[model samples]
Target: MRYLRSRVVTFCISYALWLTLSFSVDWQHLLIGLLVSLFAAFLMGDMFAEQAHKWFSPRRYLWFMIYVFVFTWECFKANLDVARRVLNPHLPINPGIVKVKTILKTESGLTFLANFITLTPGTLSVDVNREEGVLYIHWIDVKTQDVEEASRIIVSKFERILKEVLE
Candidate 1:
């Protein structure tokens, strides 16, 4: 029962990704996408297999959508900020590695957070200390050295939304 549910979830996620990326409405393209996505999902179901009850909840889905919106906005803002710094004549930057803590208990959540930091402009996740729940991020503009403040600025509501969605 659990196996079937995991495969279904994997298939849905894989197919959704395929549809978003394929950008085609033709039946031939869809048929190919369906086959490829199903094959990939069958081969990699274990990677994302989870307790179906937890993720299927409406609340979790809501939070996930909210997280997506928040992440997109932050990404856009970060890009603009980076552009401004780069175009400046003085090239003002305080390039430094700063540590930030996350309360996300699950490995998937922590990994997502790390990747989120790396994907956003002006910041790169250099390392993660899982035991200590600390992430060392290289920032183009390191505003503070304090751990709490850095976490507040870097992680912010992302952690809260992720925790709500994943846990």
Candidate 2:
């Protein structure tokens, strides 16, 4: 019963978002969108239900938004720094892979951090070891071999934000 209620709520919320963002609420379009959303919700019922609880959490949503904004600002700054280095004749890129241990316990949290790393310029999450909770990231530049420092920066700048939203 709880599952079914969650599914229905998820379907309605998704449909409403689609309606507000995509199409007008004419009878035909509304019916079609509702059917499609319902089908999708049914197909991914478990995922929807799991995330639906988080969606209703105002604190998580607020923290997620704050994280996104901060991430965008950081990305922009990194882009400029990378561009400057690239355009310079000296080419100061010290590309290498660094292994950083991740503190996030959940798969979703780790995946989010990996995706965030890849999305930002100058670094890419190449591999993740679930057993050891380690992430191998390729960085365009490395000033030092201190993996702990790298992990600290990542956790302080990004993972903390993710934890606020996800944990």
Question: What TM-score would you give candidate 2 relative to the actual structure?
Answer: 0.85
For model 1 the local lDDT of residue 16 reads 86
Worst 10 residues of 1 by lDDT: 46-55
TM-score of each predicted structure versus truth: 0.80, 0.85
TM-score of 1: 0.80
User: Considering summed lDDT, which 10 consecutive residues are worst modelled in model 2?
Assistant: 47-56
Model 1's lDDT to the true fold?
0.85
Cα shift from native, residue 86, model 1 (Å): 0.7
Q: Model 1 over residues 1-167: C-alpha lDDT tens digits?
A: 34667777888888889888988889998999899888877877766756555757899899889989988988898889888998999999989999999898778788889888876768899999889999999998889999999999888768888888887
Alpha-carbon local distance difference test for all models: 0.85, 0.81
Give every collision pair in model 1: none
Q: Candidate 2's residue-wise lDDT over 1-167, tens digit each?
A: 45675687778878888899776868888888889998887876776556556667799989988988988987898789888998999998899988888778777788888988987868889999988989999988875568799887654578788988886
